[model samples]
Target: MSAPAYSRPAPESNQGVLLARRLLPPVLREWVERLGGELATVCGYQLGLCDDRGKPTGGVGGKLLRPAFTLLCGAATGARPADVVPAGAAIELLHNASLIHDDIMDGDRERRHRPTVWARFGEATAILAGDALIALGFEVLAAQRHAATARSVEVLAKTLRLLARGQELDLRFESEARVSVDECLTMMTGKTGVLLGCACRLGAAHSGAPAEWAVRFERFGVHLGVAFQLADDLLGIWGDPAVTGKPVGADLLARKKSAPVAAALSAGTTGSARIAALYARPGQLTGAEVDQLTELIEEAGGRDWTIAEADRQVSAAWDLIDGLDLDGPARSSLATLTGTLLNRDH
Candidate 1:
């Protein structure tokens, strides 16, 4: 597939994304690229391919959402947005590290509209690349003489632990049945939510914001992360392949137990039973089977239930933000950013 850059919707007119852009030093972007290239080079050497020629792997990257969160949180915390660049780069690197392993675990060949690292470089190399990035993240943080408050380090470590626990739970879910909605939520929070919380907390720490403000920021990020994950689950089921960057019903084909699937199973309807039967099979799913499962979950109200839950989480996140003494161009920009997230097509 082509490696054209993926595009996101324009931020709201009132959004500070552009303002954040203005505040961001171009060096931050360059640093992220440099770090990524270093990690890739290490992977190439480890794989005995350092000198091999091939099409440049230009697009195994995402929207860098985590780093953006860190930068915005810094702005909201009264820090010069440029000051958090290292932390922002670290957050983005951490995310890509996780994604590298995730694609291997899911046996996926494509991500961000390009061949996944594992697909292009082999599984062992990809796994090592992910490990290298994780180590490099800590190295970056340690080397950031200008930032790196003790609290930021603490939050980052805690987030990393949570992410590990979440991934463990996700792997466990594949083999275990009877996953409750609560369990799934807890898993999502740990796996996806904590890192976002860490991103915001790191930003707040960078600015020397009051401890209470960091707490509130953490809460905001946690809730937003949950909502984002839920929306992602919904997309996995109902989204168009062209936009979602995957085959339609890819989740069903993998027999992955996402929120909607778990909700449908809990509904205990006949359709749910039919869907369960389809999932019980242990091999490649036919197109007919994929459609059948999607329909079964939608018919069982899983689709509606999951979407409602996502909206609730998103609203709760913003509600926390609303209570904060956040007003001004920065706050307006955040509001715009949140709205954009809620309505994203992919």
Candidate 2:
């Protein structure tokens, strides 16, 4: 059920471009592992005697995209390649904290191919763990005394706030009949875009780049984030179950207010109305019903619309990257990464 005429490929291995790939040799892995372990401990909390879904869920952590961006920014700015280690770890911890909380709010059971922390540990514990991770992420960076500590702190704080607001907007959208395009863009910026921007900014901070390049790098990340989200939304609708690790039509099944679904609904096409009718019904929908909904979404042109949007953002990201005043392999690495993220299958 992949998007027709648009075969999104699996993201290539990071071996060539990512700071982690370059730095995670055995010795470096030890430090990353140590920092991760410490982060988990800092985030661990006893959820009282009572068990509830409010406790943390358990799963493998996220892909650490933000941290990687930060490290790459550092490399671009002339920081020693080795400096990415602590910086990446810190960024990863912060991202994981958001994921822990996000799962609880979304009541998601699965993440990274495992039960969510809230689903496994209970929501109460999960929330505590999330808070702990947030603190630990900054602590790790603070302890390292990286030259960019102050700048990193500022960026991290802003990123957290933006993430929270993004989640809030997502929740708010659940009850609305329609979200204006501007509002939709704003919500995405908060939910998915800003953190990536922060990652790039943190990296550049470490590199001691001029303020102007940091801004440009951040913009590049923002464009990348928007394109990444659009690709993800497209996948949620039409991706292969084997590749996406979720059932077909899972977003429709969950009644998620994703961009494609939203677009289809706004178009008010016949197929779109039929899908809405099916969605409005109570209890779990049958397999046939889910398929019907998928067809309707496609017929309404939601899939193609989102794909075009993804391409647009990718173009914008490339433009931003091209404008950056960067040097050598570091510049080339970021470009490769941008292309990789733009074309991922999952």
Candidate 3:
């Protein structure tokens, strides 16, 4: 979800990292910090950049993946990646804004292995900061010199509505003990996929891509977004805490009813029963209970099911690319980025 992880070239795939860094230049940090600081100052707050400790950490850039997609999609449509900087910046700011609010709502204290905005700054400051970023996202878009600014703004606005609706459904689902797989998928698409779709659509629109071309890119994003969230769900349970910046079995403790958890609940197996019973209780699950819940969910085919689903989604997204008029480099970069995202351990 974050492209900052690839901000610099990695040893394994320098080219991939180069591609990412090119899309998001080194100057990105300066602008991001300036905007964040300025916005907070205007509102009588002193929230620094997402990574700013007392000293400058420059921190985790928070995986600018969505904006990278915006840049790449524009390149596919014959627009230069550098030319899409405004759109990319807007998307990236909006994403971090969402992350700030999401952490508050989820009561999460950490992100990218660091303390969250609300955890460092007060809840009030975090909330206002998020609002400021959302407004800033629009301002960035409005100043975009590209011909496609109008269409991009329209899509971004619609995506915001979809994102809000998805968040609402997610909150509603948390209270319910059982949710269908379809419902979970819908929620995931709204929360994750829609924004990614916006990134792609906005980029292509800026490049003056045909409407149908933009639509195809959007669909590509839907598949990729679904896969991304599914993988994230798996990470919530089994990922190494050191790598994930989340405690192991984090979702189990929260009883989030993630796609994998939802699948396990419906498996009708004994393992499923145990998982359901654990979730039904009012108390927070203990560490041992979290381990047991995870094992049971895996036994119920939740883990394997989610892996297969993610793979399927990636394959579908790739298939959509075949229908697009992607150039050689853009197509290759897209493929490379997809593989990088899906194979990420963290």
Candidate 4:
């Protein structure tokens, strides 16, 4: 197949994107080239490797955070980043696959300033593309020659199961009259945390780190993932659309019981009662109501609570990293990357 013609410059500011540029492109190219059909076309479009017309766009896909964690954690075991490319690539592919399905489930038309795969193509095609990506993730990992390959595959499989369960819980929240903050946190951990933990564990395992060290790395990633999701929840309701690439209050429109929403609903404030009553009456909330809901969440202390909790999680992750006896520079890189993710606007 001839190479498609177009190239866009990647953003130079983020460390995760820089590291992923070194690791993901080759694997992504292989997937696009090897699939070689409608599956290839859909996957390519979904991944930002190409446009809907099957022309290469040089797009870099999502933030590449999971793969960056994989590579950085592997480096802690004194392995070169190159040595763990398969693990990083596997985690990345899985993460994108999840995003493809998630956009469909959330009924989101736009992500990263473009139509989502399901919106651009059709739902059936997007589902197939997501499935293909999941299989490719395992295929990439299984091809690795490391002793930890089998174990890594097992971890990946478990993470997928957890992701499915998490999605189930999220869907359930939409219709249920009441959702506790604790339930919301558990759902977030399952949906977001396990995959990141899998990324870190795969990295450490592939690099021949001891089992205990791998567990520690996984825990660190779990904490970081929670912080990441909390930040995302804040953005879902209040973020600038130009920066976040999605409409502000999109989650509120969907009646999603996000962390902040759940926190507000569970609080005993009068604002909380108003929010619950509004949520209970809704067909779809008007734009004005979404604006009101945003304020209600804040007034109920949900916004403040989420911000503090995210900070606490980040501190916990840092403490765990400090206790680990790892390569010094790799540890520093991990810390920098964590700060970058927590502070991002999008």
| Top candidate by TM-score | 4
TM-scores of the models, in the order given: 0.82, 0.83, 0.85, 0.90
Alpha carbon lDDT of residue 177, candidate 2?
A: 60
Whole-model lDDT, model 3: 0.74
TM-score of 1: 0.82
Number of clashing residue pairs in every model?
Answer: 1, 20, 7, 0
lDDT of 4 by residue, 1-346 (tens): 1121111222445454578776687788786677888888788877778888888877656767788888888887777786678888888888889989999998989887789999988899889889999999999889887788787889899999999999899888877988998898889888998999898888888777787777878888888898889988877787666566657677788777888898999998899999998888848788888888888998898888898888988888777767667888777777777766666332
Q: lDDT of all predictions, in order shown? A: 0.70, 0.68, 0.74, 0.81
Report lDDT (Cα) of residue 249, candidate 2. 77
Specify the highest-lDDT model's number: 4
C-alpha positional error of residue 300 in candidate 2 after TM-score superposition, expressed in Å: 2.2
Give the Å error, residue 9, model 2. Answer: 5.7
User: Which residue runs of candidate 4 sit more than 4 Å off their true CA positions?
Assistant: 1-12, 283-288, 344-346
As a whole number from 0 to 100, the lDDT of residue 23 in candidate 2 is: 48
Q: Poorest 10 consecutive residues of model 4 by lDDT?
A: 1-10
- For candidate 3, the TM-score is 0.85
How far residue 30's Cα lies from its native spot in candidate 3, in Å, is 6.6
